[model samples]
Target: MIVLPYLQTPRARIRLAEASDAPMLLRYREENHAHLSPWEPLREPEYYTLAHCLKTITEGREYALQDRGYPLMAFDPDEQTILATFTFANVVRGVFQGCHLGYGVAERMQGHGLMREILEPGIAWAFGELGLHRVMANYLPRNERSAKLLAKLGFEREGYARRYLRIAGVWEDHVLTARICPDG
Candidate 1:
């Protein structure tokens, strides 16, 4: 099994999602449904349940073990409530050596630079430990906050895609951006 080390900033701590986090994960999703819906895929009723969270956490752990993905959860200093999540998915080995980045923060936690704090070390781990060459993050053009965040994090605009993803039950376009490994 891949044992991930904890990553911390002054305001929060990040670690791989665990089965034990199911209840809080479910609660986080439920509480932020409306806040996140515009940026995420439409969810079924079961998606907010404890069982779903358990299954997802289990699968995420398995995927991490296989080096296919890293699903991380960031929590407040109390370490009980989930404040954000950052997923490094679609990890490609060989010539690609890259992954897609997806992330979200609690509605109440926005505007605090918490996502930036969470991602800095996470991306560092991807480059330093995982040896990835590039990390891609995409956002809707209308999401100025996300655009700004990605840019601030050194992700350059690569291109745009039409109907790039199905979010909120509709196909939405996305602005593609990527950051290459600084040491590469």
Candidate 2:
């Protein structure tokens, strides 16, 4: 649909969500709940509800407008089903013009190179149109998929943090990685 400027892949079109897209987000959340639980924060029962998804979508849109971040959805050609979600969050400017990258793919779309397809341009937009210098992404040490993906995307290993983030319930260690703007 070309809704988002300068964001697309061969298999997916990346765009921010509209309020009406809440249903799609809800469906994606529900379908991938079990699949993504290990990597994400614990979700309360209400988090799966339509109203909550709508609220989240609204907040995400607000964040985008504020230059904070946005939940970029990678949708198939139909644009009805979500392929993946890439969020560039916690934007900090001034000397450190950077943000955090978080993402997840649909259960069915895993192992199909869909995430890379989405992120390649997503990061490019972050560094180009957004005019950011650095983009950081971290992952649980055991998440081999993430480790491989980040390495493939040229995110150099910066360091490791103990008890970095609370995933599911307990604190988990993370391997921090970052990519700088190539043109800089």
Q: What is the C-alpha lDDT of each candidate?
A: 0.93, 0.90
The sequence of per-residue lDDT tens digits that candidate 1 reaches over residues 1-184 is: 3457588889888888777889999999999999999999989999989999999999998888899999999988888999999999999999999999999999999998999988998999998888999999999999999999998899999999999999999999999999999998
Best candidate, TM-score: 1
TM-score of each: 0.97, 0.96
Which residue runs does candidate 2 get wrong by more than 4 Å?
A: 1-6
**Candidate 2 worst ten-residue window by lDDT:** 1-10
Backbone clash count for every predicted candidate, in the order shown = 0, 0
Error of 1 at 111 (Å): 1.0
